[model samples]
Target: MNQQYTIAGLDLPDINPEDKLNRILSSALEKTNGYLINKSTSLAHYWDANYFNLDKVQIFQDSTPAEQSSILQLCNLGILEEAYFIEKAGMGYMAKMILLAETISERMLYGLFAADEVTHFSQISSFLPTPKVSYNPFLDLLENVVESEDKTVLLFVLQVVLEGWGLTHYRSIASCCQNPHLKSILQGFLQDESRHHATGVTLLENRSLGKSSQNIVEILAMFLQMVQLGPQSVVKAVEQVKGHLSKQDKINIFAQLDTETHSGSRLKLLRNLIDLPNAKNILENLEMKGSFQPLKPSQCVSFNCS
Candidate 1:
């Protein structure tokens, strides 16, 4: 026996009579593929390490440009692949929110979002020639939250924090992207995503996290933990070119990665996003406990943040 799995399966014409209605209902509900990605026949787009600002980082400065580019190409693919799957996961979670929604307007918003997620999944998946799904911790986190959390927490995490954070992230990537097509796709996403983030903010404003407060904090902490991990991707990228690394190499790379500066910026973004009236007390509580600090290289090295 063999099995295949993907949201792309959503696009297939099912043969089963039992699934006939399932196919019909979902087909009308989703905009999967959107036929937009195939609108281009451009050649491949290579990675530009400048996206990570690697030139300013001391570690890559010593290596030749070719070596730096080699590592960045691998890292870039990893970033794109992660985005593809995360967007694919959104196709489910966004739709799931419809049933859990408190208002008809909210349900309608998620209905539209289901289509948006499909479009996003379609666009990003096109960039990969062999589009294999990969392990992503954040995707796992997203799935778990969607499966268990209520509408209020869902709005805050998925829309307010993730989408809000994503606006800046996608902009940075699109701004540095060498491929015009991919850049435009990302930019187009920003318009829709900005609205999505704003909707989350509007829905969540002054709305009590209530019993979900602890859950929301835990989720935020897990997210901030990712921030704490710093730029280990840069280290992994270096390993791609140089192969095998000693403890010292990793430490030196952390310095060059400027973990403090990079991590601080992300934490600031989260803090900005978390500034909700209802969540103000929670934010303060997290601050009191020093939750916003970046992970020192020592802590990551000891625990192997990888």
Candidate 2:
């Protein structure tokens, strides 16, 4: 069956941001969603409702003074980049839906997914303390994938691979975060990402790879490498913010960072992706060509490099 499944009658929740945003935010974070109730509230109040109160987060409760400072810097960098990537991906998905979706239902689903991404971006951006700017490696990689002319490959990359990685990463962060507000937001994102990943898997399973399997595999390799390398700009930004820290304090902060751990997780996700029933043939072809190799960490140029 070329069309593996249809989500036409899927009983997915109709997310009305106005009515449901507060409920979703409050429930996930275990906090009251009362920030938006008063029309006269300042932007900071709205942001504060979703932002983490460092004193309240469990991870930093027992840390030393230097460690607490480092964590705050890291959180700032993480939050800004998270917002940036969500916005970038949301825009890309909207564009792809308009250009490539073959059915009305598919288009509708993508539209809703895009809307959710924007909502996430907006809420996260609101929480920033200052205007922060940094380069995002993963977002750059996603742009490359979106530019490809092959819609199937695009779907596989964004929905299946990237979103799958996102689901895992978000869950990991949310579980460790002591702040209920951020945890709630991450949960909301996970819900949408799960749906997107499932749909991508089904769509890819039903489609024939034909001659494009090799291309798809190569794209997957590039994505894995990007993950392993981590984001240079974000690292640099964090370093700049923590420039005053002593040498040992710097070491402590880096130790707490999860760059290597995330790389390993992403690599595992890639392996599982190609091990799926429908992906067996593609995997065999790559293995025969001796192209299946583990990526090592290195400082690489932007993802747009050939």
Candidate 3:
């Protein structure tokens, strides 16, 4: 059964921004740091905790001087790129919602906003000094897989792979969160991301590789490879934070961070949800069962648009 999924499948509602709690959060973040963009595109949706109170989120504001410094730097990076990415992806997600999403429910909408922002926060907070990789190696890989046959391939790369990884990270952080409110907020977002990931996988997987305009097998493989590599920088950052700690402090801090990161359902979501039976089937179809290859942004295509 070869078929193409259209935006028509998406039942996105025109959510009034004033009604959303996340939008209120967006307003808060903006007050804290005004650089965060607030626009949503036809292809993207923006949801942040400023609007919704799915769970009362306790702010992780207190920290050791070092931890505070580290976190501030992380927030700085967000001010530079993460905020923009959040806005950009939000626009894209909204566009997708309008195009492909079915009737939006309160749960589903809450999920969308929290999931997207949390994932966005996770990536930027930990991976500072974002690399200037010309082509976004993953996107390059996607372009090569379809070989220019479709623009939708870009959407798949961002939505399915990049955002999928973001969901996993959010779950991890949420589970590890010290503040109960923050944890609850993250959990709510994870639920939304689960649906988003499922939608992406189902849309791509049900269609056979040959029938689709792009190579489904290759796309799936590249996504998995990209996912494995996504954390190297954040891990490096974490190690840097640990390096400054005394041996005993290191042990305590590491334990604390580990608890925050590897706790409960977060670990399960990271391992099981991402490595789903369907995702595994797609990977096998792509013949990427072997270890994933490390990526080089330099080898990717260069942008020379005048």
Candidate 4:
């Protein structure tokens, strides 16, 4: 039997061979995970290494095939690691929301959401080379908001805005993913995410930001800043495989990324997400500040994320 690392968790534990109670609990846990896997739409949710389309990525344009392959793998690993942590972060926020649920119905919705997040975490973790739980800017921001003791603000920002954005984010990944099985999971997960997002829309539809407007704008601005950090992933992936790049190299790579198109599409989708009726004034203010504009690769290339 595999040794148990955690004394308490939803994971099936190593049972005492002779302990009937332990065996029963282990059996139940095994079945639970089995159900969750099926609920995720398939049991063969493995990572697919199908060739990544780099035609638009530009960095791979002049690279040798082997170099391109290396960068692709690194990029995939980074994306999966980030997804793993982000989904884990989803579980964290869902659990917190369950505790913060003001009504039985709200509690039920969050309970279901928590289960969905755990399933996503399990599936994404299978794609990782090794387990990692590192800091993520979005995750950190999410954790802070959960601790902020305002349910309405939480709903508007997390569910209404972020999860609303996730519909497009997850759908885009699913559409382009080569792995049929993982694509199915992403598709299924999006359905749940859609419902989770709807919960916020239904709950806060007409609720004014009121006293929370300033805090809401500040939190949202941080998210916009993250949006402005474009092509960083591609640049870093290239550097990892090709070593230190000159500024010109970075700028050239950024140009190849078709950053204008990426930035425009992303900013447009983001604007639509937060354009709620109750947030009319906030939306106008954000638009005025160009908070919804995507970053220009040349300008962003010089901005050091480190």
Separately for all candidates shown, the number of backbone clashes (residues 3 or more apart, or on different chains) is 0, 1, 33, 0
TM-score of each: 0.83, 0.63, 0.42, 0.82
User: Superposing all C-alpha atoms, what RMSD in Å does each candidate have to the true structure?
Assistant: 5.0, 10.0, 12.9, 6.0
Give the local distance difference test score of model 3: 0.41
Cα lDDT tens digits, model 1, 1-306, are 111343223223322436556466445435443443332222243456566767766667877877876777777777786677667667777777777888899899989888888778767766764445444567667666766647788888888999999989888888878888788888888888898899999988767788887788888888888777787777777877887888877877776667878898899889989988789876987787677898776665555545
Which 10 residues in a row give candidate 4 its minimum summed lDDT? 1-10
Report the C-alpha lDDT of model 3 over 115-153, residue by residue, as the tens digit.
455444433323233323233444344324322334345
Residue-wise lDDT of candidate 4 within 207-234, one digit each (tens)? Answer: 7789887778888888877777665776
lDDT of 2 by residue, 156-226 (tens): 76777777877887776666655577668767778877888888887787787666677877777665555
In terms of lDDT, which candidate is stronger, 1 or 2? 1
Model 1 residue 101 lDDT? 84
Candidate 3 stretches with Cα past 4 Å from truth are 1-87, 100-164, 179-181, 201-206, 211-214, 217-222, 235-282, 288-306
lDDT of candidate 2? 0.55
In terms of lDDT, which candidate is stronger, 1 or 4?
1
Report lDDT per candidate: 0.73, 0.55, 0.41, 0.70
Cα deviation of 255, candidate 3, in Å: 18
Stretches of candidate 1 off by over 4 Å are 1-33, 36-47, 56-66
Compare the candidates by TM-score and give the number of the best one.
1
Worst 10 contiguous positions by lDDT, candidate 3: 297-306
